[model samples]
Target: MSQEIRGHPQALIDAEKGTLDPLPGSLSHSKDVKPPPSDVLLSSKEKDALVTTTTQEVILSAKPTASSVPKSKRVVSRWTLWNLWFNTYRKFFTFTFGLNMIGLVLAASGHFPYGVKYSGTIVVANFNFAILMRNEVFGRFLYLFVNTCFAKWPPLWFRLGCTSVLQHLGGIHSGCALSGVIWLLFKVVNNFRKLNVTHDAVLVMGVITNLTVMISALSAFPWVRNTHHNVFERHHRFVGWLGLICTWVFVILGDTYDPVTRSWNLSGVDLIHHQDFWFTMGMTIFIALPWFFVREVPIDIELPSPKVAIIRFKRGMQQGLLGRISRSSIMEYHAFGIVSEGRHAKYHYMIAGVQGDFTRGLVQNPPKTIWTRELKFAGVSNTSTLYKRGIRICTGTGIGAALSTCLQSPDWYLIWIGSEQEKTFGPTISRLIHDNIEPERLTLWDSKARGGRPDTMKLLKEAYHYWDAEVVFITSNYIGNSEIMQGCKEAGIPCFGTLWDF
Candidate 1:
């Protein structure tokens, strides 16, 4: 007699005698099994059981097939062309405004003398200067400016443009060129005892050269504004030496000649031209005295290998009206070589002298304990569990400090947060990422990308969930530090931050 199977079709067979696995042909036969005509079909509950079983089997079979499929290709999002145009417009507006201020100052000072006829001329000139400031938009405006100003002399423009480009190449090149010219002039005057170069002439030349150097150095301010402070300082030092050379050339040439006699006589300036000679002699001696008196003394200090030693006075107590006779001297030291390798390390020392009686000399100090604490925290090892690892979130300048800490510990995961057009942390981020840091390990939370700071918090929570972050390190300069820390506390996570003591 034939019998109908109930529940799961596979369950109807005897466990000891029957095989759970289906034969190849039997598997195809199950798919062929169908309900009878509607009037004679099984009850609703029985139909429901059969449908559920078939669905489960289909899903289980599809799982293996889906697992073998490759991941979808990722598409990079590109900024719209209009966004680039808007940035160009904003930069143009800023440049034009600055030039307008300069034009107004010149016109008020009678340099431009603005009238109805000159009104259009003034606007045109201001606009041209603004265009010249932007490299991408400068070529046409620069050509027009040169053509108009020099009476359409193409050669003059060529020379001026080339000189301008070279001058902007770097401060070191400009400084060296200026100093070399002045030094050559000084040597020529000293060697030629027959021709007399007047002291006033030398002084005027020195002043003009110094002023030119100063203006050139100041012109770089706009470009250097976006650069690192260390780069600016290096440029300043180069320009400063040029100024000192100009001063030296004037003093040497002026003191060696006799103005009254109209001849070069290097008899100590006292025998031939007494008064004028003594004046020049005194000035030159005064300028050279500091070189002799000021000396760099080395001090033992425990810190980084390339640390700078700064000796600052305790305010009030110097020669000049600026109340800062402070004399500074830098002593640079070079290490022998690197351990196991041949590389060498270098160190610099800067010492300043306060011209006062009965004062004690201070030595270089050690690094603060807080610095050590931060470094230690940054060196924490990575872990599989989020609770055991630390998360670093930063904004503004704190990004650099945080990134430096992050790079030292590669095993740990990092969550970096930033704001729109806020590049204060860009240097740190770029450095870490360029070193091959994992993308999955980093979650960049941008405020602008998420609407605002409130939205940033929501996204931060989502990132935390994605990364299973335990410790949160915030590096923002904004005043909402307390709010962020509170949120982390509420989520049962500990937070560390810069700009806030907590």
Candidate 2:
């Protein structure tokens, strides 16, 4: 047999060293004999077989001996930690909050003239921006604009930066929301101090609005969101709606009533002329936009295993979108990554792993109809068009997020690491991968069959160089995401991982 094989060169080298054991269905190798190119197709005869075809995959059944173990010592320096700390998210937050702080200092020093009169305008302006940042319609438009204008035309660093910026727009949203609340507090206090011009009704509404906004913001704290999700959702959403109502009252009262005359002006023109009124209107429209798309849609649920539920929706979606579903229009809303072949396909799917109450309910009592918005939101993967070629690395359910990009675009490579992939995810997901993904562009590491997880960093580095990929997108749990991100940072490889803060 010739030493040169069509498969991954590293696999051939490992075989030559007698350090790797092939899985039962995989092609076996010996010192003097090399496997043929066609032999890379793993047999489908095995029980619960993981069907894969390709040369670049590593499917091992036995654990490597101590002497054969690959050394994957990660060295992260303080510089790398600092770079990670000052990420795109923090930068957006800092820039926005810093500008607000400067304005606040000016107002506190009494340098900003008419600070009391124009304070409402400032508050509403901040809120308008904050709401816009979170608006699904605006978000989709931004992603579409970026992908259309700069996809594969810009330099690698520039493209990576664009994706980072898109992913972290929530930072701007957070900073503006907190700043708006602070400005509202200042406005309310100043109105109370200026007793002559401020009407009592306006002051009361301001106070109530301030409290509602504060409560809504507090409910969104990470601890509250992670530990008591239902509480967070209710308080954040319902209280936010109450805040908006109070804000409308405050704006109308403040704009229409003349504090100097201690009387109300019922004229509609004066209310329409106020800057704060228009700003509030813009934000209200943004806040209510998604709700306009709300509908009760029929769904088909396939329960492959107790661990996961595959949900199929009517129309196919483009790659890199996420959909939020709920049992009712006002309750238990959860966001999941979407998997669709393309817009032309008959349907798009969401992989609902049994992670929480809503998802668990899907497996326990599947619903025939569910509440969802017609317009799905965009995610970082939506920026996949920016790169010429890239790698999508995900673990377990993360595959739900990572699979569509690879399926839709042949230039993208996929590396899915999981245990009992076919059995846990079922035929729907299995068929999608098998039918769309070519063997040369895939690496399915079944940790259950392999005895343990492979060195993922080593696998990623190998793929990054061999595939000549410009960027890497990772979707994994906290620890796995952290480890892979750290490795990528140290290697100076441009990459993006799942964002937990949002």
Candidate 3:
């Protein structure tokens, strides 16, 4: 009684100091103390406060250390010197070519005195003008509508109407008058060349003139200069080639000039006598020869090929100016590719739009499995065949269908969510997961997850960071809403999804 009483008093004192250790092997006294009954346990509020306090402690401990440093800036490459050299050489060649052409034009005309006087000035002006016009409003419009109706239509209509009005005014004979006027203008210009215009002098003048005009015109149209860079490049190339050809022709014609009259008289004696002219002509020929003889280098580029492709044809869409009920069809082609050293695979689609009767009403026919078989035949094997090629899939609705043929690919990390209607696809997905697919990689997002809607963007971002996804494949009947597409774009991710309408 004395020892028990003494121990009990010490234990009680130890408990008060929160240092009591229970005795071993007894329900009433053990090394590990049992938790109190539910009624005696801490209240919900107290439990929540304790959890909050613990979380705060953890966060404080995780704070950045004094030695931790901020991230450094990323460096990008710039080929400034190369670009400068390119621009300088390009401008020089372009200027020289233009000047040479104008000289030939002047020499072809017999007006030697006038041609000699203004040829150099005109070349400079023309060269500038050409450069300026490259970025002008009219030039941009022409470029954008090249090979289209816009370029062909308005000009044709205006010229036709003007011609008709002129014909009425001058009667049937007015056509002859118009022709005569044009011929006169041509003869006047040719007279300058006939009067012994120097080919070199004229060429120099023409190039300078073209560049001057081009620069001025382009300067006036700042918006065109800023926006249509591709258009400017094409125009520059075409103009350069045209100038080079014109220069060649001018040199040949200039060499045919008569020595006595100092004009392009085309007498046989003058051609034979002009050795200096021949040398110049040879130089022009040498420059022109390379352009015509150069061949296009062929390049082999591997492009994406679809397996189990799906096509959706939407009819009765309006198009063009005819108020016609235009038919539209969307061809969604899905395929799979292995990425990241066979550790991951991606499913992607190439969506194309087709219009008119040929593609119209095409969605009425049911999607056939023939496409899938064809892909298999064309050196693309299913998941059972090989590990590297990965799988191919296509999805559709109505007459539209989705097809997927697997290859020996790693299991994809798919966060699949669906309602009751999607039960039909459950078996197919299950089969995919069971066979060659990894369970941890698959995320099934059913209605039960977080009252539905489940912060898809947050989930996708997390997945992207954790899994390092290369491609995103989303299949849902809700293609009408554009939010999914918008989100994907915002995330800088490409999406493979079905399209019901154009």
Candidate 4:
């Protein structure tokens, strides 16, 4: 069930390793001393000392000081506002919902006779699209198509737009899901209006299905999903399953029963010909697709510190793919970024930085086998190939999401800012960073060693120019993501950061 990923150009490992080529006007800083051999494991104290020294070297080598970097006046252009709106998750949600609302208004006003058949069509179609947007297989195909077709050849704006496509697709999923519920409500209400015509079973199914769908939708609201994730997870999933079952029953009963003739047609061909029946089939397939790839796989968990568990899985994956794992096959699945040296590597990894119940459990008692989707989904970083060169910046466990891009692509530079680089993430991550990434194209800033957070904006601005990067990708907590994204916007630098919408 696992999807394979192709490796990037192996020239990255060529022994010559090539010379540092800084962009014009970039600081001519001395290249970092090559990292020690992979076989040599450094102690935590030694690694911290090395990182401290390296940070100092980078600062000293750079010509521009924090104060010397020009501060741009905070100016938001009309075009900038439009571009931001165009790329946001909310925009996709609004677009999907807004389009549906127009039809809903017409249907509700009685201007259009959108009876049970028409409303049922809208409901199933919306649900179908909603499920597809979040489908792992479909999502991977989309990333592959975009990266393959547009990588490095498309204009910067076009490529940047492509990156936003996957990240905010949840908006479409959410919008369509809610729209489906609304349309179902309309269909059910219409059924009640003609109780004489509706069958007793059909009426009962309509009411129950509406309630189930509404419950599922309400459970998925931001407040419920964020504050009570377990509640949201269980209700949204279990209730959704119940809703799907009801929908199938409703489709069958509605399609087979003829109110006008007071007759029933149970023929398979007749059921196949019904539009709602086919739509329900598509909805069922889309919802059930990911589960088909589900399997229990053996895993090796490495607890570097109490805060993080580095998990190793069999086989390799491309950068920007995420896999969902759970202790049980039915519930409590959590997603973490997959880090690998690409297809040629023996295995891929997931950095389970103890964030929630499932991750904390990994550190408390690691499992021998964990339930997971064999086919992983793609994220925005998968578009790394679109840019000739870019920077992957992150903080703390955010490195889990950012590391694979730099590891997989020599065209990418890495800047991992964390409290304890080695102690927190353990040796597995540290080794991956040191062994795979060349020192000249890398920067590791340890806040614990440096005493406090570094001036991130200054560092990013410096790296953006010094590395000659076409774009900057960030994976950090909300505050850090906001600060860096805002700074980049003001500086007119193209950048993407971790999305908080989901």
Candidate 5:
């Protein structure tokens, strides 16, 4: 049993000094929705019964008081978020766009020359709506239905395997946006070439719309976004608004151009009937929906340390839900997971690690009120509904994202690795864990107390075996999260973690 995990060597060395207690006879079960008290450390005697039915060899902990934990065997890992497994949405859009291109070629041959100039813009706008403006009323309701419907039906492992791809929605947004830009480019060319001499009203609008679309698309490039987040947000928001407005001007002029009459027709219902008009309308609503819920809610801020800010909101978010709150409604919005008992819980809290401008402001100034978008839809943890049991792995501030799931359900196990979490995150979080979580199910590895980081992979492997977990969710930084996620994948275990595609 030899497994290789990032920084595992150091971690294993540190873990050698730690201890796991022996099993007590007869593990008891709790009936209350609330988790049993911290005293509920399940006995090690149930190890044989707890390990999953997977083919992987299960090694129970040795009986010695200070026995070294067994090493885990490694399996080859596969990429679930790339190529065929991941980006299926992107592929679908690409294939559709490709078909459109072939159709354009056929139309060029005068076989299907229907709705050339007007249709292309509509298609572009429609694709943009599919991704950019996803939070519309009907759209959100439909998603909620799908998310809820799937949760109660599919077998846990099977659903866990499938819902693991939930984060790929961003890829569709990326694909369709690029395709829309390309299609709009062609539409602009057609509009310019067929510039009605008698009614050249759309010529300037076409040029401006094409340029704006291109800027919006290019500014959203992954590298550009990663390097300059502010630029990405500004262009994606401001230029997107400008482009959307130009799209209205571009489309109306193109639609009104009567090819035979060679003149513009100003009509009411006809314009409304056009596909681009409805698509743009829907997109606008989706873009505006989040802002509608924007309110400056009272926030109680507690700084446990300079490294961490435990910010609690008076109005609780959905349990096991993650949300975004900003210093200003329009800017500096960052996504963080919420920790609350449930709907009945008095207040929910978000952990703001001193990362950037927004977080740094909250830590230093401790705002009395903060702006939040209250859309109680499926978050990353909503996918957790797919599994009957799983392990949540997080490091430092990542614990904020992982803790809520463990708190909400008895089946989930939490492995939180950080330096002095009790001191860093303060009594609020510590007491929450101590009060609600069973001690056996929660692993808090204090790097300072342990001399160094514990063997994360080993701890994960042991937890997976100990708890009969079907899947693993990681919420650490890029390197740590990916490393453990990849390790789980290689070990023939289904895994889910943060995907930074957005």
Candidate 6:
């Protein structure tokens, strides 16, 4: 998705028709996008000219840059550790997988110290580790603490480097999950080797869980999630829950009620009895806690146009609010950024940008009741606490993600780029922004008015210096987020953006 598909289809309309309020009246058009003819301006002409999608030579040469140097060669030559990590996500997963493989190799070869006799425990431990990493409560505390601390820390670049580590926590989630699966398989094989009595229940549960985990991992593959999102969501939700249930049965059976004895054991009820059981219980609680908050609440949706749906509802306290709205709570869940007036606000809003069948359905036929989780999960911009001052850069409906953080912190600045942003999102959002936000701190870029695609990298470079911004918060498409992040990294400026690696 173009991050803001809500406006993209509408961008081709006449510029004067777009009713963006905050632009300077004396606007001058740059090459593609126009800048406000005010103090907050685009970069110098030379800096603007230097920015291009194609190589430097392509813009200078009469022919394509590929004519002078093949596109493949040009790209490969520009590769660096900094660029590789910041520009793409594959490296993070690959690194995690590689580390897991190496650890397993070392363990099997007698170089690793952890005992093989407790392989089953190791599996449970890894599973617990994965669960903890993905837990919303744990994630909130961990991210907020680190971000707040880094915010106060004097070493700007060092704290930024530390903050960057936060983005890759998903690595631990992936590595531990994969490792748990492998350890689980080994555990199953060992169980089979020692089996003499009827372990039909244990074997069945083990096999089911193993297959479930493998399928869950495969379904989470980036390509699968992007291409067949519905399938990905179904498998992850249904298969994941099934895997946990089977795991519960397997762990209880394997640890307490041995098939050899086939007798009820009182020790199974002991809270402190076995480490595996406790870990399993912990994982189970982590899985169940969110469902406790799941309720189908009444929704008030405003479909301003065919492209966007402004969903309003009175949720619980808006603190750290981020929700998933789905037609069916169990079938497909999509995360949306929560926008409220403030912490004391009685209600919040969720902007559903038309991206898929579910979102399209939401716009075409608004639902009376939508599923939502009570506990507000953490978002990328939740780390805004880490910066002394920052700029929230967003595109399209992406403004939803950054809007709350900026409102909550007056020190922050917001620059939103979209085509007909004000009209497409409707008056409620515009009224909220106008009433609360000072005109000086907000910049609304109407792309239809401004010629075409925006050079956000240059815009970010200028904003960082102009606003005396210590950090930048970006909530846009992967490309926009990555490009701005990459620009920040290259300039030695601390920045945070959503990797969406999950």
TM-score of each: 0.25, 0.87, 0.24, 0.85, 0.80, 0.78
Q: For model 6, how does the per-residue alpha-carbon lDDT over 84-150 read when each residue is reduced to its tens digit?
A: 4643233554675577677667766778656355676777777777777667677668877786666
Instruction: For model 6, name the residue pairs that clash.
Output: none
Per-residue lDDT, model 1, residue 190, is: 36
Model 1 lDDT, full chain set: 0.31
Output the TM-score of candidate 5: 0.80
Off by over 4 Å in 2: 1-75
lDDT of 3 at 58: 10
- C-alpha RMSD (angstroms) for model 5: 9.6
Candidate 1 worst ten-residue window by lDDT = 1-10
Put down candidate 1 lDDT per residue, 1-502, tens digits, no spaces.
0000000111001100111111111001123223332133243344334432221001011111332222433222233223322332233334544555565456545685552223322322321222122221232244334334543233533433332332122222222222333333333333343244445566565455446444334433434422332343344444434544554454445555566776665565354353333333433343343234333333333221111122222211100001111123322111010000001212211111111120112223332111000000001111111233346654432333344334434333454444431232222224324343344344443434433233334434544544444456554443434445445545555554322110
lDDT for model 3, please: 0.28
TM-score top scorer:
2
- lDDT, candidate 5, residue 66? 23
Error of 6 at 251 (Å): 1.7
lDDT of 2 by residue, 1-502 (tens): 0000001111111111100122111112112322223223322133113334443343222244442234666667888878876788778878997898789879978888666569999998888888787788998999999999999987788888899999888778778888888989999988888877777888889899999888887777666666777877788778888888899899999888887688889999888999999999988888888888999999999988887789999988899888888999977577778899999999899887776788889999999999998988888888999998889998777777788999999778788877777787887888888678765567777665656667877677767765668899988776677778889998878899876544
Q: Whole-model lDDT for model 6 versus the true structure?
A: 0.62
lDDT rank order: 2, 4, 6, 5, 1, 3
Sort every candidate by TM-score, greatest first: 2, 4, 5, 6, 1, 3
Q: Give the range of the ten consecutive residues with the poorest summed lDDT in model 5.
A: 1-10
Q: What tens-digit string does per-residue lDDT give for candidate 5 at 221-278?
A: 6565556756766776677778778877777776666777876677876787777777
Per-candidate Cα lDDT values, in order, are: 0.31, 0.75, 0.28, 0.72, 0.60, 0.62
* lDDT per residue (tens digit) for residues 136-172 in model 3: 2322233234323332234443433322222122111
> What is the RMSD of candidate 6?
9.4
TM-score of 3: 0.24
